[model samples]
Target chain A: MCCESDQPSLTQAGHRRGQIQLLAALSAIVLVWCGLLPALGRTTVLRQRIAFLEARGVNPSAKFFTEQEAGWRNAAEVERQLQEHPQAFWALPWRHR
Target chain B: MSQQSRQVSDDSLAMIAAGLMLAVSLCCTALGSTGGGGAAEAAASAWQNPLSALLKLPKSWESNPFAEVSGWLPGVVGSQLLLGAALVVGMLICRVRTGEFLLPFLKVFLLSVLAYVLAEQKVVKYYGLEYALWALLIGLLISNTVGLSGRLRPAVRTELYMKTGLVLLGAEVLFGKLLALGLPGICVSWVVTPVVLIVTFWFGQRVLKIESAALNMVISADMSVCGVSAAIATAAACRAKKEELTAAVGISLAFTVLMMVVMPPLIQLMGLGPVVGGAWVGGTIDSTGAVGAAGAMLGAEAEKVAVTIKMIQNMLIGVVAFGVAVYWVTYVERTEGTRPDISEIWRRFPRFILGFLGASVLISLLYENLSDGAGFVKAVVDGGTKTMRSWCFCLAFVSIGLETDLRTLSRFLRGGKPLVLYVCGQALNLLLSLLMSLLMFEVVFPEAADVLRK
Candidate 1:
């Protein structure tokens, strides 16, 4: 008889579960960013590793092939173009000059 | 309409969007461009293989548009409009609900920004971690935890965003640069990479008997080629699942951090001179920046050689993607004994690959012809497209993460074939690259080593 009664208890289960999951997910992110990452960053191993890379002039942060190589020269070239060409693709309204 | 027919149309429409974007970029690039020395710079940088020639990036994040937001507001607005047309068009055309797409687009844009900021953070960037992983983590967090509501579901168009990103990636594949390093660089990168990739894949399929062919291919390409970029291009070409791509990228990044740190010191200990050491590092390391950084540890010469060889290897992204697309259509999906019909192959083929190739060919032609074409092309790529591609990819990863079931990834990991395949493939790449670098630099054409000094 208890099982037979459609008391909407089962109907609300999905929503209740979703809410709980959301809270857990949020807590995980907060813990990682606020607690875990800060703690990890403060470690000697990570700091020394970062220092090692810096000394070698290696950019460990580069996600793609063209990224490190695509620096400085591009900006210089663009500045040159804006100075030379009356109308350049990059010659928009925003220039430091 | 059948799902198959719908997919064919979907791919075709993506190509159209890419084509439209390319056409607009060419118009902008073609209109006002006149200078010399850019090609001279190109010629010199060819052997050095300056990637700045291929793609544009800010000097640093601090000076880039993101940092100096107000100062560069107009330029930012213009570039975004110019390059983001394909992304916006992609979503709009997929299923027209002009009003509906806006919120979803905003959601995706915000997510991408968040991922980008997280990746760009000093500590994260310094550790060799990247935006794609952050985006994926964020996505997985949302999906496995709170989950996507109906309103958010519309923006999780992984294929569309990924396809557009692939096309942008294609534009950067300047095949003409492959010969810049001569035969030795070609041998180290082109010959060794494909051989290692093929052997690794066969080993996975025949020896290990991995269940998922797509997973095998992603790991192989990511190991052989340039990490996440190769994984992405391959995943799109073969239409691998989100979980498969996520796994492929995760493995690639983990290995890359290990390889980048260990390779330089190992190379130095081995007494492989800058040319050979740099070539070996360039040929082996998964990520581009790490290659440069690793190469620099040897010397300035080694750094140049390393970056140049990697740039040459980077061209393989297009060829391998196209080849994989063809192979998948022809053999992988074939049922038992029957040959795939031409029309069937056409239907099954990933047409976005065609967009990818088209962008490559178009941009290469422009770079070749104009007096100041190199400058003009550089302007186009550097000004906006790279950022757009990065954003699109970040969005795709986020979408993938949202859709993923963590259990599936854990299940795949349980097999352990992927780890074996990566180890074996990387081992082969190391052996062959070392042999080729030594042979080309020391034995056959010793003079090729001199080019590095020049």
Candidate 2:
């Protein structure tokens, strides 16, 4: 039953076509890497935005918590600040004014 | 192909994967100590932002693509080889013919690698399209168009890969970090997130009348919680189809890119300040990276607030997964008028979550109590297990794509109800999250905000 011959004609056709499609997909990846990706990176908008963010010491593309070093640094700093100012939790909102 | 035979096969597969999970976790933990005291202290301090962690990030490819690829390619290949070996052993234990499976597994791994490399492209990463999506797309294109051979069917083991990856991910979800934000962070994440999740889920179930409850739940969790990770966790808990997870990830990530780009500007225009703006972005944005990106744009204070809140929220996956599992056992999967036994729930519960939770506990303890543990564990994770996890998930998505039929998957989304549910849920999340962030960071705990601005 596990043999390919046991598969119906339609199923067999799908397997054959899938092989070809897989090749096409691989080709597309190559095209994108070689062409589309570099082109997009060079675009004015993305380049400018990334430059601006980098200048500000922000990583605009950081997707996960671990990816952002500034984040953990800031977390430690926040903890320290809170420790020094325990009353901040109850500090009057108007005090900021 | 009898039910009994399938059950036995599943048990064998799980037992083997369990061994693999333990091996990976232990190795990741042990690898932390390899850096010696000086390196560990340096990394530990760096985690406190006092320097080199960024140098080791996966983005190192930008500076020296070949060198970076050569550096990581070996580790990824080695880990995947371990996974492959384990599966082969499992197959042998099950008395399945080894020859039939090997070639298919190789094909899938190679294809998944291709997809992973493609997703790593700077433009794709910038657009926030993760490797999972690319893997699924490539597989889907092949399966739906050319169609796959029946011979390749033996290797599409999505569940195994997901379970293993989840265990690895568990190591990353250190519970100790949850305290970093204190009460203000808690109010914003714990209070607003679940409210938004439950309400959104209820809206999907009751109002939208979504046909597939699993789809509704996954989309709800993905939008409300931390995007792909939440969706993956919930989907596994509820045993949602891979196609549903794929769709949920697609919808959430697409919107994540838009929101990540748009929110910082919008916040500046509104003059919400970094605390509120960071909180808003953290709570509302689906992806952690996007949240950080958005927060960084607001300024360092906002980035910290945004990320810390999001990281705290990330911890909720443990509770959420357990809750969903319990709910599913007690209510969703119960037969009409029959009380569920403890044994039934135990059997039905997703065991991978236990692995996830266990890994989290193990790492959290190590991070908190062990001397220089933070640096060591971070080393192991950043160096070893993290890359392995990326490989695991990429393979899982590829397998999912291979196994799913596009026509059937489209049927799940026919009514556009999922899209409506996501948009509406996100709308609620944005509104509620904004209010809570204001109340917590402004009115109730404005002092916390003041400290953050420093």
Q: Which candidate tops TM-score? A: 2
Candidate that scores best on lDDT: 2
List ranges where model 2 is wrong by over 4 Å. Answer: A1-28, A51-64, A67-71, A86-97, B1-68, B86-100
TM-score of 1: 0.82
Q: Chain B TM-score for each model?
A: 0.90, 0.90
Scored by lDDT, model 1 comes in at: 0.70
Candidate 2: true interface contacts recovered? 0.41
Residues B1-454, candidate 2: write the lDDT tens digits.
6633553454456445545644654554454334435554554333221012221223422222354675556555566566677777877887877787777888898888767666666666666677778788877876776666677877777776776677777778888877667777778898989998999999988998898788889999999989988888888778887778988988998899999889999999998998889989999999887787788778877887888888888888888888987898788889999979998887776766777887788778978886666665565565555655666778888888877677767767787999999999999999999999888887788768887787
lDDT at residue B4 of model 1 (Cα atoms): 67
Cα lDDT tens digits for candidate 1, A1-97: 0011111121356667867876887687656655666566668986676566566546666645445543223223323433454232222233533
- Residue B353 in candidate 1 has what lDDT? 88
What TM-score, over all chains together, does every model reach?
0.82, 0.87
The Cα RMSD across the true interface for model 1 is 13.0
